[model samples]
Target: MRASHNQHLIHEVLQWNGVIARRAHLDLSQTIGRMLRAGELVALLPGVYTWARWAGDPTVRLLAVAAWSPDAVVCRLAAARLTFWPEVDHGELDLAVSDRRCSAKGFRLHRRRLPPEHIVGWPLLGEDAATDGRGIVPITGPALTAVDLCAELGGEPIDRVLRSRQARLADLRGALECTAHRSGNRDRRRVLVESRAEPWSAAERKGHRLLFEAGIGGWFANFEVAVGGKTYYLDIAFPHLKLAVEIDGRFHEDDPDQFQSDRERQNAVQLAGWFVLRFTWYDLVDRPKVVIAQIRAALARCRKLAGIR
Candidate 1:
């Protein structure tokens, strides 16, 4: 298509206020009609059409949606999704708009005014346009996205906060700094700090600490053992007693090859006469006492076999 026609299409999709001149050469309305009739484009929102089968970045779609509504801003999990922060799995679009605007049928709209500080610089479709696909509107930055998530979570889902593989200490710190500068909610700032203090996958660390607290001796954190001239790492190990403990998370069961490899390693260790104990998320969350008991029993058996108290 010609550059002028493409601009006209974008303008039509965005419902630009300017009147089209009578002398304009390309008929935008007919062009759009033909494209839709041919299945070349689909209307994702009123006045917002995308090419059929355009499975480009979700951020791009969100940006297009925001373009369809100039007043809309990205918010909540939608913003976090753009920044690649792992938290809640919200499958819907969340947009923030001026309080005077009514919520759209398919979109969740939060009515609030975003301060200049909370808004970050993003490349909109136009040069110097103040929007991005990363958040409610492109105006939401990484720091704002993190703060919004922390606020929404009430800081309780610490594990999910840590599991955000994209969220870094620095990003969180930057968000907090912005929060402080903007004088946002004090409680939210405190929660952000607490969230930043530890890794996202803290459940694993907590499980490890609980075992130590339960008086399980000879256990080392992140312990490496050399068996048959090959190095293997254990979450917890009593090397002298030939005991190994493996802590399994949900993702551990998802990978068949890793599961098989783990089984082989366990067999090799057992063939060497070492006791192997495995713990899962269920064990850690629902049956801590049972986990400790199992470990203690394994240690006792190892001691008995070695003739040691």
Candidate 2:
């Protein structure tokens, strides 16, 4: 094959996640071994090769692994990285394969075939978009990926996927049902059940649980509040009393910009007659009683001000 022809073949295979196998280019097969030896092409598997340029791209590596493993559907952290949250474990690759005999190096394989409804192409789908998995690398739907990772990540994935609007509560319930027969599923069920509040982050999830266990109701998670000309989403809000509970996660401590913006956001809400209470991970974890007490006190004070019976 000419150098240009070699580049063409490599680009072709890389784009498909190795969907177009080596045999499809038999006319250039005679030149492949030489190119591999010359370092112009890199072999992902015995029969899979891509241009040397893409050998280091993380996504290319993921696709190469998928191409190497027959019937591989990206799942778990890999699925989340591809869809809603990109900052997850970038190098961890997990795939689902129905083939009993399938295996791949450096990747975890779940040996169950997902139902068609449980898989979608990369970039994710809207809550109701239907698909036939044509012309794309398959990935477990956001709901299935969230439920699958619950045992490892708790309610975080469930919360994030729902917040992204790529999956519904029913979708998560259904995914849980699909995995109910598997062992070590109690955590999955617990996470999904706790996620009914649709908390946006793990800290918010924990905070919501604190309120739930204390029988604190009437608070909305990620409540939208419009003040002045801007909009803000309160981590947790009591609309009736105009009380906002802000969960300050790691970002609040590390990012000065976020800290500054939060101050501005709080100023706006407070000016609009809202009472705000802020809590950190330590407040929630190390002093649950104190957190609850503060919330109860705030509720009482707000009620006194609002003259609610």
Candidate 3:
């Protein structure tokens, strides 16, 4: 077939692979090349191809990559994306493949012999099967992909994965429930349950909660206090004691404008007689007890000074 004609055929196949594949006797190579040259297809892996920008769906790219290596299973952040895990960025691509001989361009590959239970159908990919470099194929379903990613990445990438807003507890539970009857990896599943038990923003919340839990209640969260009619919110506060806490995220240091604004707020709060306690992510994560103790002591001092104790 001519490249243009082949490109047309390829588009037809991408839309409905089984129908076109059975109708066209054209070799896969010529069709794939035409699709690539025409910018009608993106090579996800060596043999797998998908319509370029299939609505900017990462799953399409994932499936295309998996199509190139039929044995390849989507994993890691890519798998998280498929499962709708929150906080996972769509930019990174990850796949697992069993075939050592198969390799692809612009993909991160994990080689392993995935059992049949790990593989599942994709109704959206137009073919029930995933594409191997040579033909359409099947791969790990969203649930298994999510489980595999959580098991593989542990806690390190959990923050980013959660941030993507794709993966949710409901989806993770569904994936885990699907594998409930199967044996092995019970510990890994337990880890997933624990890791996801709290929201990814747990650290931020915990910093605020620690003060209240430590009997330093009466503090407002994101409490808006104004001076000169300009209002600002405090991460944590004790208005009665004229105390405020500000959680300094890393972004505060990196952005100069934000840093300056923060300084202005600090100055304004000080003029209002509010003693500010600034904490960082490191303080929240590393020294929770110390941070809470400091706040408790500050509260005591404030009470004494105000004759409230």
Task: Please tell me which predicted candidate would have the highest lDDT against the true structure.
Answer: 2
Error of 3 at 101 (Å): 9.5
TM-score of each: 0.50, 0.84, 0.46
Query: Could you tell me the lDDT of residue 154 within candidate 1?
Result: 59
Error of 1 at 196 (Å): 6.2
- Name the candidate, 1 or 3, with the larger TM-score value: 1
Candidate 3, residues 258-282, lDDT tens digits: the string is: 7899899999999988899888888
What is the C-alpha lDDT profile of model 2 across 126-214, one tens digit per residue?
A: 22322533235688888888888889877778878887988888988898787667765898887878888888788898899999999
Q: Please provide, for model 1 over 1-309, each residue's C-alpha lDDT reduced to its tens digit, 9 standing for 90 to 100.
A: 574676566457434311222123245656665667878666655555666665244644575555466666776676665555545566777776776455444467677666555565444344534342322344566556656666556553433444444445566666566545343467666665544334334445556656657866566644566678877666567888878887777578898997888787777777777788888878888999998888889888989999999
**lDDT at 158, model 2:** 85
Which ranges in model 3 have alpha carbons more than 4 Å from their true place? 1-63, 66-73, 79-92, 96-156, 161-245, 256-276, 281-290, 298-309
User: Which residue pairs clash in candidate 2?
Assistant: none
Please tell me which model should have the higher lDDT, number 2 or number 3: 2
RMSD of 1: 8.4
Backbone clash pairs for candidate 1 read 73-136, 73-137, 74-135, 74-136, 74-137, 75-136, 131-138, 132-138, 162-200
| Candidate 3, run of 10 with poorest lDDT | 17-26
